[model samples]
Target: MAFGTGNQIRTAGRFIRSVFLGPQLAAFLPAVMLGAYWFGGEGVLLVAAVILPALIAFAGLASRGLDLRSPRDSVTGLPGRDHLVRHLDITARATGGNDSQARVGLVIEIDNFRGLQGMYGESGAEAILRQTSERIAGVMRRDDLIASLGNGRFGIAMEKTPRVDLETMIRLSTRLQEAIAAPFSIDGARILVTACVGFALPGRVPDQTGDAYLAAAESALAEAQRSGPASIRAFTRAMRPRVSVPDALTKEVVRALEDGQIRPWFQPQISTDTGALTGFEALARWEHPEKGRIAPGAFLPAIARAGLFERLGEVILFNALTAIREWDRAGLEVPTVAVNFSPDELRNPELFDKLRWELDRFDLAPERLTIEVLEDVVAKSDDDVVTRNIAALSKLGCPIDLDDFGTGHASIANIRRFNVNRIKIDRSFVTRVDTDRDQQNMVAAILTMAERLGLATLGEGVESHGEHAMLSQLGCSHVQGYSIAKPMPFEETGAWIIENQRRICDHPRLPRQAG
Candidate 1:
């Protein structure tokens, strides 16, 4: 069931108390009018009839798209993303395909924005964004289009000018970073922020369409982010990931799933205490016959774009359950296989039953298959079906592992509310836990909290022996990353498990202290 529709909002109370005005509420006008009349008189009923439609109509337009005089972001007072894109398109066309005169498009994404949101609250995050946006806008020319792209991102369309080059983009990116790095004060507390920047030069954006230019910049921005915080990258042909598939990504995703090209690659997770195999996570991989391997990041979006999230989830679930049974047959003693479900799949009213039937069909115990939910889903969920489905899954004995812990809005209350069995410490904190004092302190705090709550903890992205030693000392139950074992196909798991079993060391290998 799509979360965007009424299936998720079956209750009248939820509809009434919903913070955002939705067009679906249009159908409830008659009921609302009757309620108004019951509570008040003809005067109130007349007032409701006149005012409700206007509000709904305005909200509907805003929800669909703001078509009138280009909309501005409420917090930043800058143009919205659409306005920047439109202006970029106009500027690009006015250049008449002349690369020298074409405008540049850049995107600046605030680093760890969600972490800031989680730490300081939404309003604090907004204040940071507002101040940062003003600084960014000030860095650009008065006429150069600047936009608030939401999610701690800003889009910039440079005024069409000649002599645009990589050097110019780099200089401008530096200025933007400087602006973002400036400390922000929210209620007497000073918060420092950094941003990654990506820009596409006019000539690099092939069609010079606003959407294409923006996408190129975003791709570069992704590259910059991958490099590190406060990094900058100019768009290049190589930045775009190549998936050796059909011309259309969406089309290829549909065919790949049907042809069995997309499947699970199991990454082993081990007990940090004993280094014994506890389980493996079933991460999706697309293996093209010609290309050998395709990155999930490249095609997963295509799956979502094609509205195949539910289908993808079904495929992964079946593969995971099958893997668990296979491991059982091989006497591997692998306890469970974790599979992630998209928000759309979690919202399905039939998810609980579907999972039960799948487990039954595979003749596997419910505990043998772990269900992984993103912290974002737990944090932002408003759908009744999602909440009920998660609770039902927990009741049925399947462990729920919240993925990317500490990165999203999931709180202690929400974690308990959703029956989370385990928290996977995000790689951000785990990256330098062995040598970085700050990283060690953060992981220690998270582990302490988890221990207090009696929740199992796993640290992700544990890449070094020292880091593994530190996490073990800090009392993480499990660890998973390249240091343990990179993801492998089902065919390789048997031998890999056998070989890896010999590598298991005793608990407390050494009392290594982290920085």
Candidate 2:
């Protein structure tokens, strides 16, 4: 009870500090003074000033802190994004004036930060950010500037000195990564953090602006992120051209779709309790004639940019339905095949009609098809077409699964509004469920909420026997990831079914057949 009281007092103190120190307090002070004057005149005003002089002083500090033109981040007290950009601009101009001098700009992103925020609450995440910023600051030279780039990302501007070379910058970046990668103790839990570093040297692009350098650095950062944790990539000329090349590749994506080169690969979903095959998620894969097998990440964005998502979605849907029909004919008891619907595809008025037509054309049961919607799309989009089509699909007996459940701005309202049938706990939460207590608690909460709502739960990215067992013990209905099976071609799926049949039939706990 004493601890609870102390917590409440601390919470109240934080509220008071925020009220006094927040930017809006300055705007509200005059109204407050006026109310004071109107109610009790000079005596009350004097009393208020005497009692609240510290607040008034803090408000003055807040005004300076809240200045829009200020270069500092309010939370971390480090240089903000605009400050870093402006610093880059100044450095670029200075370097342009002196042909011998150059600058290096870097962007560092904390990978899986959204997952961290999900496991730890906002305050805990902010505490980690503060510690991260401080550690990065500790690694930098006095002249080098680091700034908060928002969203668990940071920007660094380093002016090239006579003592510093490309090797020096590389070493500095490595040091920064090492410092940040060290475990942080927050809220009594030790959490390991990893960062992706991307750096650009001005010598590489003598004619480009600071913003251009930053963009190049971001490209390198994206590549580093793709390479996974604690990775670094330096910007190169080849990366620059690849930016514009996506436009050309968009055409290739369209061609692939039309030429039947884009095909659906099935990643199996299994029941956690029974180890039976539940369903398959139809993932899109492109077989480019020239490039060979193109990953979806390489081409899906291009397809979306070309406004061909709807067409590509249709092709995937058709292929998935055809595969299900073929599996049925092959005497495989695969129950359903899930296909993702992008926001644009969901917003299409013809979505329901197209799905209904395809289901009827294949003579497949509506229950045999699952429609997956990303949580962000359902939570953030206010499209009537999407809303109506989801409802229509639900009414047509197609189960709706909320994909990437914990990573979005999803709420109870969103689940209720969309009438979600199943919630797929994102890979972020499922990755280390067996080891991480926070992850275990998060998954348990999600499962409990889903259970009370009468919705099923599937854990995506379940990779180990331990994770699968833990999820089953926690009441997750289904699991999917590489541990079960990689996404395979339609032809191979039949053989896989035959190979796994005995395990399915022999399990002590037989899973209820999924529609």
Per-candidate RMSD, Å: 16.7, 14.5
lDDT of 2 by residue, 179-261 (tens): 98776888787676778898877766545576777777877887776455567888776663223335788777777899999
TM-score of each: 0.58, 0.59
Top TM-score prediction, candidate number: 2
For each candidate, the alpha-carbon lDDT, in order, equals 0.82, 0.80
RMSD of 2: 14.5
Q: Which stretches of candidate 2 lie over 4 Å from their true place?
A: 1-245, 505-515
lDDT of 1 at 27: 81
